[model samples]
Target: MQINPPGTVQEQRPDALTKYLQHRLAQRDREGNLRRLPQPTTGIDFWSNDYLGLAAGAAATGEGTALPCGATGSRLLSGNSQQALDLESFLAAHHNQEAALLFNSGYDANLGLLSVLPNRHTVVLYDEYCHASMLDGIRLSPVKQAFRFRHNSAEDLEQKLRRYAQPGTPVLIALESVYSMEGSIAPLAAITGLAARYGAAVVVDEAHATGIFGAGGTGLVQQLGLEQQVTARVHTFGKALGCHGAAITGSRLLIDYLVNFARSFIYTTALPAQAIDAIARAYRYIGEQPALVVQLHDLVSYFRQQLQERGLRGWCDSITPIQSLLTGGNAATRSLAGRLRSQGISVSAVLSPTVPLGRERLRICLHAFNTRGEIDLLLNLLSSCPNPDL
Candidate 1:
């Protein structure tokens, strides 16, 4: 037997950049975490973020579909349309904020907000489990330091605040209303109360809570009655509202501050008027069809009750529509998701790097349109999920 080391078949061909990317891709494939665009399907819709069943709504239209496909330039340039302004104003009043500034996406809104509001003299405190966008923003900001508090632990957050407390230095505490991955709601009341006592500013991202929780889907922040205490609330229309774009709601002065200093907001092209109309349609739908929200809550309750009936209530920690079931490994999680898909169901497995190792799980997003029978079927499948490793 000829004993030769690896790489005996071919000489290296890719350049440095391509080789680097190839290595990364190879590693991801080995880990079963290589992501690809998903194919369209008619499977049961349990994998999407369309919590309010609004993404399937009609596309924006008026007299015709002849509206321009894009706004063509940044908002500071020629792209700020009257339609966009009207939506922003409506968002401001509806959310009980002094003003609102629209961003092209939730990512841009978080990046812009964090980049502008903090300086070298500021201490940034954030939940360890906050979204990647928020953490990325904090990483890219000019703030000299940032501290992490344990997820949903107000006591740990207060400890961070105390550790960073100093004279003349502003403290910024950021968190999500509902964490996207684990589907757990934050202790907003406790966290905000801690911020108030420490004289820290609070910035909340309400991406997952929009159009599902508060009065007419105002959001969890408004529902908790801490609207005035929080410094800024970033609400996105893409998740529950099933539209595109995000809004930064706060005082008029804060809006002015971001408009002048936030590079992400200043440098990007504005969203199209048609997209703004879609957002308006979603808001109007929520306002007129209050029964949808009620139905969603009921569905969530029913799902939880079913979980309890199956002796699985302690498996997950979420009360809202977003729920997850832990599977312990990447291959196992994907195997479970594949089993569901093979049976005409659509569900996604959260793999490693997105979540910690050995904590891979299935993220199940519930909608108002999911029937009781569908829920029962899904639970039955989950109950009987086999050992893929076998």
Candidate 2:
């Protein structure tokens, strides 16, 4: 092999890197799928994950003065504080688990849990539509045998389990309580039942379901009384809770293992006291007013009814607040999203490679704060559109 000559840049040089990146972005631009930061607007609320309108609450105005400004280090370092410990304790009790371990965000929690815990001999079976974070964790793990079953199909999951499971190998089934992009829920009870027969541990990422389903906003796993059956549940603070960070609730042994093995947890700085305060406040608020969840569900029901009355096609059928209108291609979906924005409505265009090609969609997030008139106007706009069939 020949070495580089004097002043000759290597293949990994900055010029080479910039060229490759520019090429990829040019390809996206050609497909009409170039991504950019959206300008903030005071449009109708139909795109944010602030399910309970808690983000606009008094907490954002700095209502509490007890929280520290920053976390100095990782949880294993100076970042570990009494307040963080208390919040974890509160989470454990609320979720009906033996312990709770906190992470800076939902992505961190998933990465830490899946990447560090599973071994080369451990078999991981995930849903086909699990979140990108969970998929990333699996990709980075040493896990040797991992497969995905059809989304929400417990029968297919059982088939996979029967095929790969052995007498001594440890198995784990990963799922989301609600698949974020598709706005569909998993068959938790049935999947857990299958896991039980195979002696597999079941882990659920309840990022979208938290603070919207279970008693006192615990999550869907606890709402169905499957808390005892699930091996672990990852609850996030961003979606319905209107805050930041995430937690993994499970047996004390599991948390202990993660505390030791999770590189994302051990190497990174922890969530600040302010985020912890916001989470605690949100949980307390929901505990006092469980009707907020009911109100959100009612809105979800009304939106579904509106879709049916308008004969709207491509909307996902679910009682959940997330509703996606499949538009088949990126350019088309972006056009619809732009039209909605021009009409003072906010909606998200779910495009590729976040989703597969031919599956681009306009995702609408319903909330307790939306009004009947807002939903009606959105429906009317869609009904009069020139090409929803696009």
Candidate 3:
């Protein structure tokens, strides 16, 4: 093969590549689809995942005490500290599971569980609207057979199972207890019953439901008393628990399998001691304050009522913290989000790719810490805006 002379560069210039990328970025900006990382600011905090306002709480404000910023090692190694173990145990007991294994984040937990646990003879049946992490995990799995059913449609799921269920093939039904974008609850009991009939195992991702549903925020499975039916339940602490990290709750054998075989768990650095401590603290806080959950439910009801009164009830069919106002196009959604931000509100514009094109909307998350006045203000702002066609 012919080769370039020593010290001679290729005809294709690096600047050309840079210019092309810049052009694409400029196009995105023109289309109102360019995403920018915003610096942390003091605003009417509504965009964050801090559902209970514990992230900004007094735990970080104690005199002469500083929280560690990060975790330095993986859980399989030196990271398997006492704090982490205690938190895992606490979660297991609280959720009524035989064991619990913590991961770096909800994403990692999903990745670890879905990717590693399912064998070649296993088939995964996931919800159509399951989170990205779960989808990614399934993609990484060796199990060649994975199918999706309509969101929360037990009948649809049953049909899919009937089509694919076979002897000696383990069927794992993967779904979320509470969908993140839609804010709708899953039919856990019905799904579990069907799974039992089909000899399938159920895996529930309780990222959104944890710390907001069930007794002491154990999760939706616990709320519905179907903990024993679910083979694996992923509980995330980032949302309502007001902390970081996630755990896969199941039988002790399942935990052992994941601990030994999950690449995402085995290859990654573990959560820090402080993060583990925070998780423990958050669980304790939730257990000690049952009234917080009551307050949150009351607030959600009030918000829904206000939405109905303002004639904006058609925006979403959610009674949960996540409420979407479908604005259709990316440009319109971005414009609406900007306008809300200008009014000192923080709502995220769920754009194309994060959601499907033409289904872009604003994702408004409610918090127990958010006042009634803030909710009213949000509704009042929405009421004034020209209604985009549903």
Candidate 4:
């Protein structure tokens, strides 16, 4: 191993510094962990979250499409547009919410909601395995009082509520409808029922479930008929919708409160007209073609069945499109991902600090456009891998 002395610059005469960086780089390379930006190429794509394959379709294609590539400004200031209002109206009606306020991304939506909605007197109980964005939002929150229960354990949530429930303090329960990394579904109905019992408001992040779960792909809340039960629901168009931007759906009063008090929503410029138009078009497409969702469910079932048949069911625990294989060490996980990529699969290695230190693994995303043959080929490759831990 090499050590780099302090204050050593690349042009300076420091053999130790050069050796130190070189050694670290070599370690990563040896473990198949050295990451590089891929030279863009057309290939069998299994890595993207475009589950319906709409992003690459003719709908999203246009000449000079890249002109308005950047958002330019935040939503509150120069970013406001008619398209944003139109999308909000469409989303509000689609999800049966009073109002919908759009944000830059799912992360921003969560941050705006969690950090601002919970005041000093509020208590936030979040799922242990919730996405980093939600955690980050909670951290930014003015409310210092927060705790996490076991992931998707309604009993654990009830226990926490019993301990933390107060008369005047607002108890906000944050959980995702579908865990992005594990692909496990959350017990939305049970959780909502518990919240009702305890008088706590519920916030459900439907990033993964949007455009794939409910009728017309509204989300898990709509699927379970608990839209009115939950206090707030966050939906992102980036994944299954094949568009960018996220929205927080709740009462018109809540929307008004966020507009006036949520700093992230107030200070930022809105999304452009084109982006909003794209989301509207995506929703229209979703409404017209209900078969896409059915196809996606079928594909997910087919892929899971293939895994079970190959005796690799133990490697994953997901029924949704996001399947993960837990290969404990970062080194092993990266190696397996590299091997899969070389075989022309686009699976990615989820490494630490994204997950716990020893839980790093390969994240495989399934899409409606992916054929049964591709699923079989990928599973066969997985079965043949020298490291089956992944």
Candidate 5:
């Protein structure tokens, strides 16, 4: 075989697969919808999901600890530890569940739960605006049928349930406590009521609502007192709790089933002791400081009041920290975000296919630590723009 000289490297050219990938990326770029990892910027924090401003403190507390940096194997193997078990116990009690099982992340939790829980006899009915992880999980599941209901629409969900809820077929209803893009809270009470009537099991992904909604930051399922109705709830520590990893709260039977059959949890290494400690600390912190949630709600209210005062429209009616300004087009949304970034006010321009093509918008997340002045500045900048959408 001929080889390159020791001092020289051979030139590499794009293969067919590489060329196809390049074409796809080029198309995305041309459409102004190419996504890039955000560079670190020293700007006012207005885009992240840190609603209670807990990420930094929780992570900082975990730093310099004597805990292990890595888990050696999956929980079923050498990675299992007492700390993990204890944390799960705490989570179960805190969330008013009979049991809890930890997964590496919210995506892992959803994937492991949805993919294996529903067999060929089950049908999945999900909200149209559910998170990507939930959708992906359902896509990978072996369910005989899956259908989407309109976002937070109990009537549409009822229609689907009526159509699909048949004898001998188990129905699974999937929901999010809070939709990521629209920032709208799911009508959990209504949705759960529907599930009860249809004899369906409800699974809620409370990734965005965890650590900001209920008593002691449990979740909206608990806040609405619908814990008894929901079949399972996935709470993630990465968002409001400002830590990593996620847990699914349900019956002991559900947890046991996941332990035995969930591929994502069975195959992946468990989270490190440090991350578990961080999550523990975050829960304790939130429990001790009740003002964080109040402050966050206050900020959201103030922002909304300012929006109305400034005659700015096209905002999503989200009571949570997530607030969206509908900019309508990919280019316009990106331009608005870029303009904010230039002024040291960083926000996210959520574009399709993250959202529908015509529903592109700027996602502005409010934090407990964000001040009224910062809100004013952001609104002032928007007021200066001549976009009719605003």
Candidate 6:
């Protein structure tokens, strides 16, 4: 046996685990879908979730000034603070809910809620395009069964609810108010109607809709007058709010239940004081500047009009800040993104297996800060590009 010096680290050759990992990565590389972290770049804003420009603006306001950097411990322990509690109260009122529970991010909120809410007899029927976090949460649960309905299709959801939902058994319906990829708005009224008829609880992920919709950015659930119909609503701050973390709004009983049973919330360290303060400031800022939301909507309308005037077709139907244009195949979608980036425009290309294999698209996000001239420049390039390989 060979031995090394006492302080020297051992060097080992590649093992089966290393080879397996390499093989998986190689497969993805061959498929033209290898994922990599992108370097930060500056240009016209067309790719971020910051719809209201609050992230930079709030930072300029010194929202998190002179605060601690870390939470110290989990919320169940020494991490909990009075500031957190006060912020929760403010969020509850802002969202028109009896109570609100905070989580580190939208993923954690969804995972924590879905994993605990379902029992062995509970059935979860979710939209096909629901976020991966929601799907992972359902997978972690002890729910009786889970099924995917067509994306934004009330008829398909109703069919599954009719077939699978049994009498006296709890049924959880999951969907997003505004889809991140497709930029399509959910038919909340029709879905809520079905939920009421079948006695199912609706859980709406208002991540993309939270900071851009409703009066004072309350979200689509409130904008459409469906707050009372929703059992729970998850609003993420990293998007349009220009902050970080997320909150689940619901009945006081629901908040209490999650506090006791949700492992993600119970086990993880709470958000730091700085984050909590920033969230509060963001809300206050939006409340004071209602015109920000109006400006964003006006920009959305302008974008659509430009697309029509340019006679550019194939853009997905969307009335929100998130807009997608389908450019099928990984090579084609990535090529399109490269072309845009070359022109000093920052945009994201959604490729498989994020979406289905043939459903690759370019996800373009609009913001209150974006100008019509910048939008026209983006559209001019898009109109000139050749058709993508499907």
lDDT of each: 0.79, 0.80, 0.78, 0.77, 0.81, 0.82
Off by over 4 Å in 2: 1-66, 388-390
- Per-residue error (Å), model 2, residue 386: 1.4
Over the stretch 113-165, how does candidate 3's per-residue lDDT look in tens digits? 88876766677899999999999999998888999999899999999999888
Candidate 2 residue pairs in backbone clash: none
The list of candidate 4 runs beyond 4 A from truth reads: 1-75, 388-390
lDDT of 6 by residue, 1-390 (tens): 111111221222132222333555567678886543233345675654445554344465556437766665677655667788888888887787778999999999999999877777778999999999999999999886899999999999999988987777778899999999989999999999998888788899999999788877888888887777788899999999899999999876577667766889888877887899999999889989999989999999999898887778779989989888888789999999999999999999999999999888999999999999999999888878897421
User: Estimated TM-score per prediction?
Assistant: 0.82, 0.83, 0.81, 0.81, 0.83, 0.83
Expressed as tens digits, the lDDT of each residue in 84-195 for candidate 5 is 8888888887887778999999999999998877777788998888888888888888777989988889999999988988865678899899888888989888888887
Give candidate 6 regions above 4 Å deviation: 1-65, 388-390
Judge candidate 2 against the unseen true structure and give its global Cα lDDT, from 0 to 1: 0.80
Pairs with backbone N, CA or C atoms under 3 Å apart (clashes), candidate 3 = 73-270, 74-270
Clash total of candidate 3: 2
Give the worst 10-residue stretch by lDDT in candidate 5: 1-10
Clashing pairs in 5: none
Candidate 2 C-alpha lDDT tens digits along 87-145: 88888878877789999899999998888666777889999898988999998998989
**Tens-digit per-residue lDDT, 322-352, candidate 1:** 8888888888888889999999999988999
| RMSD of model 1 against the true structure | 18.3
Candidate 3 lDDT for residue 382? 82
